[model samples]
Target: MKEGIHPNYRDVLFVDLSNGFKFVTRSCVATKETGKAEDGRELPLFKLETSSESHPFYTGQQKSVDTLGGRVEKFRNKFAAFKK
Candidate 1:
């Protein structure tokens, strides 16, 4: 609530480069880019490498690792000498 000590927060457009998804939200990030939205309004543009639209986890394309099985196999191999 202090005056002249806070960065300006305004509506900015975040564009997902991988999927071309854009959304307007308020942020204090600085950018030198600008773009026009579908509503004919120009807003500050921020580019992102990955977003929910293109992320593997959000898109249900994430790969599941068989870590438990691998660890069990390693343990069995390491303790094989004791079994004998």
Candidate 2:
């Protein structure tokens, strides 16, 4: 309820640096850049490295891991020891 003591809350863009993805939403987050997204004329744009488009879960490209490695058996043995 105070005046002149609050940060300016406004709409801003959130950009994911890893995949060049960007989305517009109302947020208090501050940034140096500004832009307008008009209703009906706006189309949200986003780019992602894994968005069910190239992910193994969606594409059925899952790979099986070898469980015979010393690390794997060691971990299993460690848990088995605790279980006993």
lDDT of each: 0.94, 0.58
Q: Write the per-residue lDDT of candidate 1 for residues 19-65, one digit (tens) a residue.
A: 89998999999989999988888999999999999999999999999
Error of 2 at 6 (Å): 1.8
lDDT of 2: 0.58
Best by TM-score: 1
- TM for candidate 2 is 0.36
Worst 10-residue lDDT window for candidate 1 reads 1-10
Q: What is the TM-score of each candidate against the true structure?
A: 0.77, 0.36
**Per-residue lDDT for 1-84 in model 2, tens only?**
889998776555554554544566666664555443444333333334554445577679899787679788899888996886
